[model samples]
Target: MRAALLCSAAGSLLLSTLTAAPATEDRTGAAEMRGTAVAAARAKAAGVDFGPCPDAQDLPGRMQCGTVSVPLDYARPDGKRIELSVSRARATRKDPRRGAHTVPRQGALLYSPGGPGATGLYFPLIGLLPEWKRIAAAYDLVGYAPRGVGRSAPLSCTDPKRFFNGPSPAPTHPSEAYKRERVAQAKAYARGCAERAGDALRHYHSLNNARDLDVVRAALGEERLTFMGSSYGTYPAALYATLFPAHVRRMVFDSVVHPDPARIWYRNSLAQSPAFERRWADFRAWIARHDDVYGLGGTAWEVLRGYERASAKLAAEPAGGKVGPGQLQGAFLQAGYYDDQWPHRAHALSAYLKGDAKPLVEQMEQHPEAAVEAENSRAVYVAVECNDAPWPTDFRVWDRDNTRLARVAPFETWHNVWTNLPCAYWRVPRQRPLDVAAGPGELPPTLILAAERDAATPYEGALELHDRLAGSVLVTERDAGTHGLAGGPNACVNGHMEAYLLQGRLPGRHAECAPHAEPKPTAPGSRAVGRSR
Candidate 1:
């Protein structure tokens, strides 16, 4: 995971630039409390608490780990509750240069680490980075595992090994047999979830996640919220902003998700197929430019043929009796998310074609813990996405559309289909996506960042979100493709991001950031890294 995607506690503000926000009355007691008959269904109810964090002795000030709780269903606040694993780090240091105890704390920043399922108790670890050091002095940092995530009443369908290590149908061009297998797999997976989790799956959607944010805010005794979310995290952050606009002090959404009616998620994922194909070309082209070093191909087409050949060989005889065609493609998929890893992935591919499979096998992340993490992330992803909105229940609608998309964009169309097909058979009833525009209190201006060629979340999604949230500013990285833009290599994007969080000031209605140069190959003494315009 990118450390940048995980933010920590807030810190000292550039006093000259920081603006203090007004206090809003705490609304903890504002929401009506209901009956207690359902209390038996819950584990212990919890409040925000902080204490020593292990293995973080070197951290500035101190890092704390604790627990908070939210109802499984907000409609019944006093009902069955689930625990939230939370971490905190306060940037409440005194500075004499300004004045002793002169800087009042800026509101703590609540961070979401991209995965709707990603465990975020590690959010404060981002403070380990030098870039966030100055930013950390302004406020406390808060991190949590949302409901149904790790350490937060986690939901699992079956023996995770079956879901993680089980054989998968070829994601490449699939036949009717392959399609049937996938449909069955998806159905079984959904059924397993129901058997294991029961009605709990219904509460795993984003609206509830947003609702839980309020419980967290009230627990912290803060009147307002200052939030930063990345990737899928953007979805919930936007929901929190719209559903509770008055409580928002500031927000930053990086690599925005487009949850509009036309392509919110079902269609949105289909779009990623083509986007990944385009990004694959970028990776292929880069490899072609360094043909002499890799000896794989002299052009993008040639490089692709090398990949196809490798996939065929792997499919016939799994590399090291483990990595198959599915593993091969999965290894390369990382290039679509972060270009910085391109050189590394390409080298792995190169080594594989030359009859050495070590590098390629490593990309599969063979560690026992890696499989566990992947399974949990996948479970949460399916639970949240399927429960969030409606999907055509008919497998034919999914197959027909994905087949059409695969004809033109074959890189990940079917692969993505199988990954999300579980949604079609999802047992939970779906709701319409919430209107992410301003709430009744009216939202303040927000800052949104997008890479021009983000494969996971297209740049246009950011533009769409900019339109949805009135007064929000949009920052574009002209030619980049990384998934999380803020706290990335782009200094310009981070400048605007830090300023917004620190000063609560909005940049221009639209801002443009130049993409940094593609990374130089890391082959020994190959070349010194250079910056691109």
Candidate 2:
């Protein structure tokens, strides 16, 4: 799995120079240039037959499910087709009017939720929220599991335990032997994926994912698409827009990724280090504010010292024989992702420091059977990211970069490197990433959201995308650090998102919204705000 995707605890703001525009005509001219592929795809999509979802009783709302058969290799549409599982909740209001801009009731509002491996089948549930009810009422809320993900011929490596439950990426010390072990493990992981997934691995790149989206668009009988994507999900969403510019109606890319061709996976992971460090400082300050309740420390530095001490102690003697230093770090990493998780994480740490291990132990424990599912996610994450672009081949290059980064951003630098180390040994051939830059008047107005201090996909990435995509509006959540800004706690961000989705309104120019207030100390026995990421 891409470490950047997994490091997201929960899951940014800015404005570009671009402005909103009227929807463009479907680029039938471009479609014609693609020759018979477009017609063939349309014919196949017309034949799709939707039925009751597999777990209709379990899923929310009136969620119907179906599958569309797309070619494993789009170049050969008639050959080796793969079924992509799709779910939909039809719009409630047949006609939704917003001001003078009444949205025509057509096409589905498709969404991709970050993780290259995250299943989108359940994402339509977001449409049920009161704030998003208007959107659901105007368009079908659509979600689909990308190829190699859940229910879509899910791929996996041979050894589940060996891949998931192995040594921590960040060892306390980087000895020569440890480096060798990591290298061997990475090679083994790469070999396992190639041996297990075979030719399927080659077809799992982001381009194929974009192509798959078009097939879904054709199947839905819609001329254009409206999309919302976050984290790694933004890459595919943007790529789809680039490939089929005229087919895009509206797009929301939150916590945007920098689509730098040279730094696709490797350098992107490195960029998160400093961003995570900034978030870590913010978390420490929050803990200090509640020192009276948790008794961890009275200053940010003090709180950090306490955490380091506790981590070292756990490294020596793990709590409840399970929550070691690595597990402790993993649990606390959530705090940097979302402010809502701070209280719970602080309470857990306080309890562990006072010799109670239940909270820490419970947080780290996983069901034994979940390893298979985890490996499946990992398999897809690796396939898409590794196949999308090249990673450094030399272990020494990675070691050098990580070692330098760990000096200042120790929180996630080394761990992130190991999380992505397998890419260096990937068996699939790398393809040059698509040029994601959109020419002037080529794409519909896009809303780009970014936090000032996002850790997973840094704030700078949002700026990069804003500059590249012409006619896009950038919305910044000033000083906020959470990932996946839209549908989050901030009404300011969500308001703009809803406006664009419902009425196709873009901010006049670049804009910024105030961050939500941080949580205060709660009385003992009262529940915390709970996890937000």
Candidate 3:
């Protein structure tokens, strides 16, 4: 997931200082010149109305939606304008007291969940994060879909069918044929999206996103902005501090990504495959301990063998007559992202072992949009990733590195490589990824949170980011799941975040939190959970 930050600054920097801006736009008659291939997309998308989502429960405050205009290119202050859609929940408790600081209007806390395509506008309904609400009470809690994502000028193909509808073909191992074929597919996907997105696709880089955040800050009427970022949002927030440090106030970055310019944003996922396997073993061991329940195996090794057998079975005769590698991988990927879903996975797997295929099939089809979401996610993902840094153009280099990594991380090696296949067709060539060097010149003192076992954003990445940010105080969860471990009911993790949000206190000297325990499962005959989010 990603976090969001805001920054307010003077008008754009000139050409010499504008070296970092992602694109250049012609200024004359720019408003009338919507002459890009995406004109049809923009036009068709325009009619799809998104009415303001009213908070029906009357929880505490009201939410308002508005648009902020930013330059298409930050280097040219007088350049064409791009609209950024934003929403805000005004402070619930407003103080009327002595002039100035006593009266609250400090600023807004903007948030994003870090997909190059993940929607940030739904923060209010995400019950998992209660800490976000607490912060909203004091400061306006605002969220916006970044460019090329969600309601703010979405990025999609003209005939965007379910991207992951078909079964995925599994590769035995990285071989010459596999490398060439997959590379071609990746390039094809990228080309399709580029042809689809047209000019809008070119502006989908992180630099533009960072500039968009600043525009949102200005529109919100904040003199300076506070930030709370996680995962990919950390990259944009960090960029804001560097490009315009003086505008930053207090900030928090959770599950930060490295901003080194040399790194390939998409290729980076390639390196993470083996790491995911390491965590998968931990998961298997946990499952094997309950062998009587799952019956996969009594040992982790046996469990892996069982999985291989199941996968092979499905490969030979597709499950439920339709299930494929895409569905299986999607189910497996869910467990990798968060530990809370482990039971759900266990239930599906156990049922499958018992020759009951419905549960497993249902789980795989839980979110058909998941695959499409994965695709669109990859589009925005590559737009930002490719622009962030240069990737090795040589197929041999990628093949060699992936081949080496697959030796150990075979489970996700091919899966990840295929996931990023679109990068080969990305419209923009490699640009320097931000070198995230946080210092006195950038960012205020920040609070950073990380779960020890988070596979997506590993703990080491958090520690490294913490080291870079001079004002950052790191809170380490001894054993936890997923990236955003805060705002949950965990007293240790939640309490630390609460204090940071309400009282601005950090845990002294890198405090540790107890691992989270999964909620006990309900028996078949137990009363039903009427509804769930």
What is the number of backbone collisions in each predicted candidate, taken in the order shown? 8, 10, 8
Cα deviation at 225, candidate 3, in Å, is 1.1
State the C-alpha lDDT per candidate.
Answer: 0.73, 0.76, 0.62
Clashing pairs in 3: 2-113, 2-114, 3-229, 3-230, 186-421, 259-434, 261-433, 388-433
For residues 316-424, what per-residue lDDT tens digits would candidate 2 score against the true structure?
A: 7777765677777776776677777787778877887887777767666554678877788878888888788767777777776677666767888766766678888
Error of 3 at 422 (Å): 2.7
Candidate 3 lDDT for residue 49 = 26
Error of 3 at 130 (Å): 5.0
lDDT of 1 by residue, 230-308 (tens): 8988998988887678878888898889867545467677668778888898989999999887877999999999999
Better of 1 and 2 by lDDT: 2
- TM per candidate comes to 0.87, 0.89, 0.82
Residue 420 error, candidate 1, Å: 0.6
Clashing pairs in 1: 9-141, 10-139, 11-136, 11-137, 11-138, 11-139, 12-137, 12-138
Ranking by lDDT: 2, 1, 3
Worst window of 10 by summed lDDT in candidate 1: 3-12
